[model samples]
Target: MKEQENIIHISNLEIGYPIKGNINNTLFNNINLAGSSGELIALVGKNGIGKSTLLRNISGLQEPLKGQINYFGKLKNSYSRTDFARMVSFVSTEIVNVNNLSVFDLVSLGRFPHTNWLGKLKPEDVNRTARALEMVGMSSFSRKHINEISDGERQRVMIARTLAQDSKIIVLDEPTAFLDLPNKYEIIHLLNKLSKEENKTIIFSTHDLNIAIQEADKIWLMLEDKIAEGAPEDLILNETFNRIFEKSNLKFDKLKGDFKMQKSHHRKIGIYGDGPHFVWTKKALERLNFMVVKENESGQYIKIEKENNLCKWTLIEDKNIKEFSSIYDLSIHLKLQLKN
Candidate 1:
């Protein structure tokens, strides 16, 4: 397959705000990143790491303190406002609660750059707007008022609006913010589909690390001193996440591809089981600060058995043995035993 062309590039970028004369409160610097057509890139960082600021800088909503941003091999400064809008579309995190705006009208607003001086929608513009609504699965709600839709549906409408703009690049700040779990996954998956099917370069900042790792073709990880850009797997293998929360009590689990609290174990317990039951039982025990080991290595142990498709957990300590039908019961029993 032919590789997609690079759509945006950043070099030596420094993002922040000017504090005083000849002084700037730089959030991060020396950033180098690139995005290709048909690529979905996730911008990730801890809270207050300037992820949003960096997004704004690259999207042309804010000026960088230093360095260059190029779009389609031309300096970003060279493009006129309308031309730039035609090439890049930005979606902010703010919720749209307009009481009277219909979904179609909101999405049609994206054609502002392409409309005539009188702001009239041509036949081509109307077709494009309707197509965009279909692309984001919001066609059925075309006549529905914006304030009447659920948050997830509203987010889809926002994305459809960008699609109507028909820009090569889309920049969103926390697109999944305030959405439910299913909605979050749906929104990210929709972005993934759009990037592939429409060949659009989609970039979004997110705190949803797991979903980002799973869905993004590339990731731009923001740190205090520098920004790291690469495939998600490459960043994980290089231990990049270890530095994200260096001063906090959170530790990234490379094997699990997620973060866990810094836990201290006071007791060792052996676990015996197979398949998912064993895996989940071990996870449950570990969450309670139990050090899981071989059954022969510990004085206390838990055994999991399946009978008629129902799971049973048996706990053994010294010469005492007790059985429970659920992990919750076993956990409670263990806690009580510890207190005694």
Candidate 2:
């Protein structure tokens, strides 16, 4: 198999904004990151941590305060405006809801860098635009007006526009920002597919760590002092996630690959069973500020039993024994008992 080529590289980079004369508000510094072709990279961090600034620098939309950005082994400054546009495409978080603009017309705008002065769409350009729409599953909406589609559909159209650009690298700033749960997953999944099938280098900044951890090939985790780059599993195993949220009231759960709130448990409860019922019961107990423990270690216990194709929760607290048909009943009973 051929090796994937590195398409974007940043070395000793500093990103921020100029506040006044000889003074700048640096968001981050000494940042070194790289992305290769056919890879989906997620840029994640707390809010106001420069994820968008870093993306803007990479996309050539904003200049880095100091350091170098290289594209395909060439200096970023070496590419002219048109050449840069042809090499990289950028999608911002802003939603486009222009009335009377057809999806086909919007996607065709991506071909501007390659078109003549009149911005005429040649046969090849039109074909590429159509193909881009089809790639994003927006071919059916091509004739639809931009304002007529939903937000998710509009986002797909924006991506199709970038695809039409046919750039080697694509930078997106919070592409899934205004989307619902399913749309968020769908957008990230679409990006994953594009990176693998189209072999495009895609980097997107997002606050959706769950989806990012699940879908991204690499994660650029922005820390307070530096940027950590690696696979999601690598970051988890090395406890990088723990460090990222150490200052907050959240901790990373290595086993679950997600963050959990640090809550105070007032009582200890043991839960014993097998299968999904046991798992979910434990979760419910934990959410109610109960520390789940081994059966032998706790006086209060909930035993999940299956009988006649139905599940029952048996609570044993001191000498009081009670059975509940559903977890809801068990939870309410426990809550009332603890309250008393």
Clashes of 1: 0
lDDT of 2 by residue, 4-102 (tens): 555888999999998999799999999999888899999999998899999999999899899999898888779888899989999998788788999
CA lDDT, candidate 1, residue 235: 90
Per-residue lDDT, model 1, residue 276, is 93
Model 1 vs. true fold: TM: 0.95
lDDT of each: 0.91, 0.92
Strongest candidate by lDDT: 2
Error of 1 at 224 (Å): 2.8
Model 1 residue runs over 4 Å out of place are 1-6
Candidate 2 wrong stretches, greater than 4 Å: 1-6
Candidate 1, residue 86: Cα displacement in angstroms equals 0.5
Summarize candidate 1's per-residue lDDT along 60-111 as a digit string, tens digits. Answer: 9999999989898788879999999999999999999988999999999999
